[model samples]
Target: MSETIALSFEEIPYDWRVPGTYVEVRPSYTNLGVLGFPARALLIGQQLAAGTATPATPYRITRLDQAKRLFGAGSVAAAMAEAFLAANTTSDLTMIGLADPGDGVAASGSLTLSGTPGASGVLALYIAGRRVPVTVAAGAALNDIAAAIRAAIAADPDLPVTASGTLATVTLTAKHAGAVGNQIDVRLNRLPGEATPPGLAVAITPLSGGAGAPDVGAALAAIAAEWYTDIAVAWTDSANLLALTSELAARYAAMGRLDAHAYAGLAGSFGQLAAAGAALNSPHLTLIGARASPSPPWAWAAALCGVATFHLANDPARQLRSLALPGIAAPAQADRFTPTEQDLLLRDGISTFDVARDGAVRLSRVITTYQTSPLAVEDTAWLDVMVPKTLSRIRYDWSGYVSLTYARHKLADDGSPAAEHAEAVVTPRQMHGAWAARCKLYERQGWIEDAERTVAESVFQRSASDRNRLEARQKVRVIGNLMVLAAMLQFEA
Candidate 1:
């Protein structure tokens, strides 16, 4: 027969008392109440040389304005952090900056001013929707006018491009060296009230011929030991995107259990985005597409992740429909996607957004790029972002509960000999009871549905291969959101 009573003390020894009424106190690790799992977000992008922060080093950012200081003003990393903070201020945020490639080519555009101004008026130069106004006097020299325009663009640190004027020609150079700089819009006027000054003929040459994308390998390697539940990726190139997806998938494995969801935006046409989306099969990545929007794709990426982190931290199963992305401009009315186009995007694994009548951009639906299983068959099991997020939450909480609770507990068979007041010796039946209790907690938290069914079907047994090991067959039905509704309205009886 086994000993009826045992005292397991990690620090205190039962061999020698040597004193009267000697006792020891130990901390309890039982988490009886609801577990709190707030998500942490990381923003990755290129940083300019002006920034003080070291390259590939992640910094925990608490203040919104800290980004502009740490990542340099007008930098991609700073912009992403700003946009994210504008959308959400509560979520834990971290940012890492990557320098532009050494051999990178900076995009350049030229505007030639000719024919002296006949009327004194203001000339508006809009770069990425920010206005740079230059006032020209009547009959001013063309060369002087060009110089004035160049100086105006140079004065603002926020502009994505730098300007230099020679004779009657002014050239604008992108601040960063990459293909992304090619999208820096250089236009005369965007609003109704803005117009080009009369008598000044301006020839526009679009910014082009930028190359050399920064390698995201260093950034990924730097965060290998760290855990980020939500990530915003700046580069949309195929190679960089694939790197992020692979890393996220690896993190989801049982060994690491450090799952993260990635969000990014692509600037392309309906057909282009659809083709790109159909080619990808991953539940860890989410992509949003847009065209004719002044804001760059990186801003969209950060904004979406920020909003998602803030809301999902509270409730992972809630739908993100109609949540407005703050400080993000919606695409023009004529450029917005049609109803049919939006539907097709959802099918192709591309996330879509809607522009309100008041010119606010809001999330329409957020889904993963996973469309099929390994056998190439259609599958909706991991369709939504909620699936992986909820699963990660459950795994974290349950793993902590079980590991700490059974750290030193001895396993035994049913009805085996044990101490009269034993709390450490656990049997298969007791293990099942713990599993059911956890499921009940999940049901009460609205994370899962039909707890009774899950409890009834679950079974626990000692491992056949190893007597010390315990295994279980468990199942859970995650709750679903209300996505669609239809109604029949009778006009007249």
Candidate 2:
């Protein structure tokens, strides 16, 4: 009189005797293998008053134009979106835009022209490492040259700066109001065989005076209950990074189980980056250093994480070395880190990037800023970005299988006599077998090593304290990345 195959009854009533060949549909998803990870990324940045999107609101973005509309052209969000889309266009992306701080002041700089040129030549000006050329005519007035510089800068709406010409000086003002603007560098003649026009002298005054970063807390809080695997943060300030580090740690806790990693880029010298990296110790945060690249560091951060997201989704255990970050500019050779410096940086916990032969920005090996454990002891458990990625996928796969297979199942002792076709009667022994099978799947996928030993040593039993609870202590050794190989060559004499 009872159906043991599946107790998930709905349409078929127990008292219905006249019905012939009546069937109920109960879908089972437990048979599926390790499912695909739902990779999602979030871009957090400030929006300009000219933008239509409301501050602190999150919106899904598939195209780059949408971010420009929401955060304004040349906005921090727009740069991040542009870079991310270049690296991975198909990943699910959400934007959380915040208004500028009430007391924020935009950074400003100047390029003053002096001396008269007897011969006309093109004057190359670099802002944020991007070239803005100003053509000069023979015997042109300095004031006119400054005006031309302003025109060139204004024509490009995506330069992250606005320009105004006063007499012989062209003033550049950051588009956003924040201390982040101060890092937008100003320089000239970055390319080989490039030089100033004859008799023309241009004085470069770097951007400064930007102050008051917005409360990124509001933007971060907006991600509540959402799983953003990778966050492209616009601000790299210590306070903001600390908030993200804490938030990610909390999310990765057992109670939360919604782990996230945040990426940010900083433009500074080797010493500066070393000092900055030394101060941070977080497994969930990654900071990249940009030496002389024209693009902002935030853009680099988005591009780096965006590129990694695609690879990590395909294979969580895969190494991300040498992955090309499309649309991200690599620093010039002179500004690039030497091999020794790179090694130092990697040890210092700052992610490093190198330039390819084709002038593309490529990751050497991305790493988190986690050097020491909670007890301040030296640790490398969470050093590489791949560790958390693999662990997250493992947890995801196990949780998926358990949630689907054991839904509403009656728990019992290991030797309990289950009814015929007892699909709803689950025993500890059955759970052990299920775990072993899952571990085999993990091993086949190359995510773990020694699947048999992992299951054999693991424990699964009914809880002694809680009559209805089943406790499982699982242990799986994650495979390591073959980052180096060394062999000795012996002479056969």
Go through the candidates in order and give the clash count of each.
0, 2
Worst 10 residues of 2 by lDDT: 414-423
lDDT of 1 at 151: 89
Please give the lDDT score for candidate 1.
0.86
Native-to-model Cα distance after best TM-score fit, residue 98 in candidate 2, in Å: 1.3
Per-residue error for 408 in candidate 2, Å, reads 1.4
Highest-TM-score candidate: 2
- Which candidate number maximizes lDDT? 1
- The TM-score obtained by model 1 is 0.91
lDDT of 2 by residue, 368-458 (tens): 9999987989999888988888888899888988888777788877665552455578888888998898889899998999989989999
lDDT string for model 1 (11-45, tens) is 66768757766668765754475578868999998
The alpha-carbon deviation from the true structure for residue 150 of candidate 2, after best TM-score superposition, in angstroms, is 0.7
TM-score to native of every candidate shown: 0.91, 0.94
Off by over 4 Å in 1: 1-7, 22-31, 112-124, 135-145, 197-204, 419-421, 491-493
